[model samples]
Structure formats: C-alpha cells, structure tokens
Target: MDNSQKRILMAKTGLDGHWRGPTIVARALRDAGFEVIMIGMASTDDIVSAAVDEDVDLVGLNVGGHIDVAIRAIEQVQVARPGLPIFAGGTIPPHAAKQLEALGVEVYPPGSQLVDIVDAAERLTGTR
Candidate 1:
C-alpha cells in the first residue's frame, strides 16, 4: 500500500504536555505509512475542525483530563462526523477506559504497544 494513502488526525485533549506516548505512537503510525496530523492541546472545537478540514481517515486522541472532558470531545466528534472512527490513549483509568469504550472510542492506556496501536489504525481505517 502507498504510505501516503492513509491519514490520521492525532490530538491532545487536555493541558498535559507529556508528549512521549503520543509522539511515539505518532511516529509508529507515520512509519507504518500513515499520514499523521498531531495537534497538541486542543479543545473539542479544534479537534472537530481539524478532523473535518484535514479529511483524515481516523482520529486519535491523547486524553489526559477528566473523563468528562474527553467524553465531551468524543461526543462532539461523533456528532460532527458520525461513523468517523476514534481511538484514545493516555492516563485514563480502567473505569474511564470502559466509559470511552462504551461510547465507541477505542482506548489504549499507558503501556500499550505501538505495534498494537498501528494494527488498530489499520483495522479501524480498513487498511488492513
């Protein structure tokens, strides 16, 4: 597959500046041949706008805030782009992961493997 054919929009949904996780994941995705757009510290509106404007195939959120905040952003993304698959990763607790999962957002908390995430992107984006 051509590496440039796949596009993913990555964002940080809170004030957290810890970029290690997202950075590593983004690199893995990019190296795997997916175009990744990283938007650090973005609000719900910003995330939505980028997802739409960029015409990305998937949305990845690095959540580091109250679950409600992440939920709000997820909800907004759903409303704005229904069926636009979204996945999240960060310091989310087990319960928070469950909540995100319930809302149809795939959650990959700390310690998740990069290969796993990249595989998920492929599956989610129908590239696999």
Candidate 2:
C-alpha cells in the first residue's frame, strides 16, 4: 500500500493534557506521509469508536495514567477492531510497557527516538 494511503488514529487515553509527546509523534507520522487523526483526551469507548469509525489502519495511544486505563482502551479497541495494530508512547513504566507488549501493543516510553516511532507506525500500518 502507498505510504500516503495509510491512516493513523492517535488518542490520549488519560486526562493528562500533556500534549507534547503525542503532538510530536503525530507530526512525525504526518511528516512521513501518513494521514494522522488525533483525538485528544479520550476514553476507552471514544478510542474504540474512533478507531472503527475512522477506518484507521493503525492506532497510536498516549498513556499517561495507570496501566489499567490504557489496558481498558486496548482491550475494547481489540474487540471492536481485531488485528488493528496499535503502538503507544508516554510516561509508561517498564512493567506497564511489558503488559502492553504482552497484549501486542508496541510501547515507547520517554526518551524514545522519533525515527523509531515513525518506523513503527509505517510497519504497523503496512506502509513499510
């Protein structure tokens, strides 16, 4: 598929209001030629609804709360759209990252490179 044809849905699963991380990631994805739809400060229901309704090829989640919060969104999104690849970044701890990885969601904690995140988006969206 063409790189520009891929669409990504980005949402912040918590009410943190810290937009720097997701904003940077979204910009990077857009720079790489992927269409990015950002839904800031969303709940599990909102995330699932947008993921399905937007027909996005990939979901990028910004988790700024307890692992359970992100997990809830992940589980619901998986049920709503199985096989829809997800990648996440934010202030996630190591244990939480492991949990997300176990659920097949790629996790990028603080200090992660933008290039790597963009590459993951491309791969997850099948635009690589």
Local accuracy of candidate 1 as per-residue lDDT tens digits, 15-69: 9798998999999998999999998999999999999999888999999889999
Error of 1 at 18 (Å): 1.0
lDDT by residue (tens digit), candidate 2, 1-128: 67799999999989889899999999998999999999899989999999999999999999999899999999999999999999999999999999999999999999999999988987887777
lDDT of each: 0.92, 0.92
Which pairs, if any, clash in model 2?
none
List candidate 2 stretches off by more than 4 Å: none
* Runs of candidate 1 exceeding 4 Å displacement: 1-3
The lowest-lDDT stretch of 10 consecutive residues in candidate 1 is: 1-10
- Top candidate by TM-score: 2
